[model samples]
Target: MIEPASITNVMRALADPTRRAVYERIASSDEITVVELTRGSGVTQGAISQHLKSLKQAGLVAERPEGRNVYYRAEPEGLTPLVDWMSHYGVFWRERFTNLRTLLKEIDP
Candidate 1:
């Protein structure tokens, strides 16, 4: 039931450290523009735009064009696939930990 494609896209889009940083900034901000992202980032505006494109393709960010600037904001729902995948494995780990806890208690008792 996990969406491999969506997870892959999200992972790939975030694999780049710069891109991940860009995503983080967008996530923390109410909204931002490419120029704002590029400033003090040491990356060119074009590069920031490209990163935004990748984020958009992964459904990680949404954009709204206003006047001469396009503002971007993080899309929280974009992480659903990744969250679902992790939750699926989280159950497995939780069960293992519980078993280990019980075993340790029995040995101590």
Candidate 2:
């Protein structure tokens, strides 16, 4: 249960390259550990943890603890609002383009 204002927070949290990479990796996999996420990113485990903290605060990720290990996974639905917002703008652009096409056809005819 995340609020709409938190969507902006989530987007801001994802603006960082490392955070985005971590998020995408989590999105692709079912669950990922902190060490796993830091493996090829050249970022320290501590840094990844910090990013994860921000992501969690933004409601973009969730974590589970299991016997001294933490696993992270993406909350894909957290991005729904942003996606829906873009969809609305997409519809607006589509209508504008359709109108332009009709106007061009009329001018040529």
Candidate 3:
């Protein structure tokens, strides 16, 4: 289970657009270096490094040093609880929308 504080930290980390982009890039790839992420996103290497640090702190990402390069990858299970929470709300909204649609149909008909 994800701790409440960790969840808050992850949400905070994801609230930044740069960090979200960085996270998405890492998620789609096996692993990436700060230089590669910077080159791909047109952000500075220092900026990418900072975002990576935040992501790592949030448990949304993990890093490994291989030789001289530090590579980052998404922690797949890190977002599971968040995703599940959103799914629960998604179902609630879906049912509400369906009821709304039926009400509108009744009113129009």
Candidate 4:
């Protein structure tokens, strides 16, 4: 079963466009630092850090400290709650689509 709180947290964390973009960058890279994420992002380093903090809180990203730079990477398992919540509604949508297809076939023939 998916926990509502976790789903909410993941959704809330990704709801912001800027934050979502930040997450995407992290997900695409094997590991990246705040300076790398800030480059060409049009946001300040502090803003990126803030976004990273939210992602970390949501379990969306994990960080490793090496030397003076901290590398951030995507946590694929963190999306389980959100994925489960969406999958729960998959049956409903599939049934609806099947009904629509039947109706379309009847109308066409």
TM-score against truth, every candidate: 0.90, 0.88, 0.78, 0.88
> All models: lDDT?
0.96, 0.87, 0.88, 0.97
Candidate 2 C-alpha lDDT tens digits along 1-109: 3356866887798899888888899899999999999999899989999999988888889999999889999998778767776788899999999999999999997
How would you encode candidate 1's per-residue C-alpha lDDT over 55-102 as one tens digit per residue? Answer: 999999999999999999999999888899899899999999999999
Q: What is the Cα-based TM-score of model 4?
A: 0.88
After superposition on all C-alphas, the RMSD of every candidate to the true structure, in Å, is 1.4, 2.4, 2.5, 1.9
User: Which 10 residues in a row give candidate 4 its minimum summed lDDT?
Assistant: 83-92
- Model 3 worst lDDT run, 10 consecutive residues: 1-10
After superposing candidate 1, which stretches have Cα over 4 Å from the reference? 104-109
TM-score of decoy 2: 0.88
Worst 10 residues of 1 by lDDT: 79-88
The TM-score, computed over Cα atoms with residue i paired to residue i, of candidate 3 is 0.78
Give the residue spans of candidate 4 off by over 4 A: 99-109
| lDDT measured at residue 22 in model 2 versus the true structure, 0 to 100 | 84
Clashing pairs in 1: none
List pairs with backbone clashes in candidate 4.
Answer: none
Q: What is candidate 2's local distance difference test score?
A: 0.87
Query: Which of the predicted structures, 3 or 4, would earn the higher lDDT when compared with the native?
Result: 4
The number of residue pairs in model 2 that clash at the backbone is 0
Best by TM-score: 1
